[model samples]
Target chain A: MRLSNLADYAVVTMSAAARHCGGGRTSAAELAAETGLPVPTVQKVVSKLSAAGLLRSVRGAGGGLQLARPAAAITLADIVEAVEGPIALTACIDGDECAVDHTCSVKPHWPAVNAALRGALAGIPLTQLSKAAPREPNPSGISA
Target chain B: MRLSNLADYAVVTMSAAARHCGGGRTSAAELAAETGLPVPTVQKVVSKLSAAGLLRSVRGAGGGLQLARPAAAITLADIVEAVEGPIALTACIDGDECAVDHTCSVKPHWPAVNAALRGALAGIPLTQLSKAAPREPNPSGISA
Candidate 1:
């Protein structure tokens, strides 16, 4: 499974939002500048996030966008599902139809896998993630 | 993140392989017939699984494929990576460089997310999955 580039940008932009929560609106253009992401890309991410109810957008001067709810309430899974969609390890894991949808012997175990995946994602909330992180570009850079 | 359809096929086909394991080398044709998957698609899944060391293959009249190791030892993640390359939430999750790779603050978190995701996947071994499942297809049509 691969996360689309859009999901990555969404997380980055959301973190940017969290950093500005209650401070005032942050424009997608400014977020793009701060993160070095393309303005159009960040714009799309902001729009999608706003559509997902993760962000509340406002228009007019000094108006932009910010988190709709507390950062603590937003989980990575929520953002992912909003930017992406329901996480499915395999379509048959939760889909209504597949070759073995009815007569498959190993179908039940998939939901467990899916649930575990969701739980892992849900464990990470935007509140925790929005914290100012060290400038390290990769966690592995810390050197075990 | 979206799962490649190939990975889904691999899981579904492997389940079929594990099911017909005791019956001797199961051919891709047989898997396709049993699972109602396209023959070519099933063939690709089997070949990929074999290449990934998940399945052992033989040639000749009775030649076919069987699990390389007990299903218990294999996790869904292993199967997924075998078919899809890797489970990465972002381009740089593997420590690769992106255009804006140099200035991101949350690069540290990406790896944590990756690790968390991998850990969740690794926790689910096929052994547990196979055992939790009955040897036969369930009576009620679970999927739509």
Candidate 2:
């Protein structure tokens, strides 16, 4: 199953934020430029992320968005759930009404499967997702 | 992001087939009726599933389609991938041309995230998704 474009954008945006950690707060416009996403889309994602508490926002000058916690403490699951809802693969898992729920034997097993998926995403810390700082150019012409 | 509607239908159809294990072959119409999915939709899903080798089709009188292997041998990952191709959450992980790929620091980390997601889906055996047989009626008035 493909992740929705919105969720994909959220991950990209969060990755950019992770890179800027400790450097200072970043605004939606800045993140959009950093991630190459459109400014409006980045704003929507930023709003959702902030509402989900994955990001903390401030309105005054010299203030913007920053990760709510250390990058190491945040996981892909958090990012996904911030943009989407809980990591349910099926609506039935979220107690949504489904016509087949009564007759569908597979209903009971979805929770376990969903848990497995969430756990998988949770295994990846955001720290691992941030790019390493760019290395300096080699001082000597010869390979070090 | 949500699993596409087709992918969800695919899982439902396969779950129905799993319930009929050893019962004989089934046709797309039969699966549609069984799962309450529309006939054309079932046909499309069945075709994809067959091409993926999750279902084997036999054309002739007294012939239909059946699971390629025991339900226990098949995983949710197989069914999802059968309908939707590889289970990557992001396009970059598939090596597709992404405009932001060059500057995206998170690109390298997606493979691990994707692998985790696939592994999670792989852990759920189709057998677990099949409905258990209804318990026999109790002869006495007491609930058994």
Q: Rate the local accuracy (lDDT) of all candidates.
A: 0.76, 0.79
lDDT of 1 by residue, A54-142 (tens): 99999998888888999899988999889887776666655546744436655666665566677778878887776667434655532
Q: Best DockQ goes to which candidate?
A: 1
Identify the candidate with maximal TM-score.
Answer: 1
Measured by TM-score, how close is model 1 to the native structure? Answer: 0.86
What's the CA RMSD for each of the models? 4.6, 8.2
Question: Which candidate leads in lDDT?
Answer: 2
Model 2's DockQ score? 0.33
Off by over 4 Å in 1: A93-96, A99-102, A132-144, B131-144
- Residue-by-residue lDDT tens digits, candidate 2, B23-76: 888888888998888899999998999999999999998888999989999998
Off by over 4 Å in 2: A133-144, B131-144
lDDT, candidate 1, B110-139, per-residue tens: 666666677777776766555644432553
Q: Score the docking of each candidate (DockQ).
A: 0.41, 0.33
lDDT of 2 by residue, A1-144 (tens): 667778878888888898787888888899998788889998999899899999999888878999999999999889898888888888876768675534777666666667667877887788877856422244232111
Model 2 docking category:
acceptable
TM-score of each: 0.86, 0.84
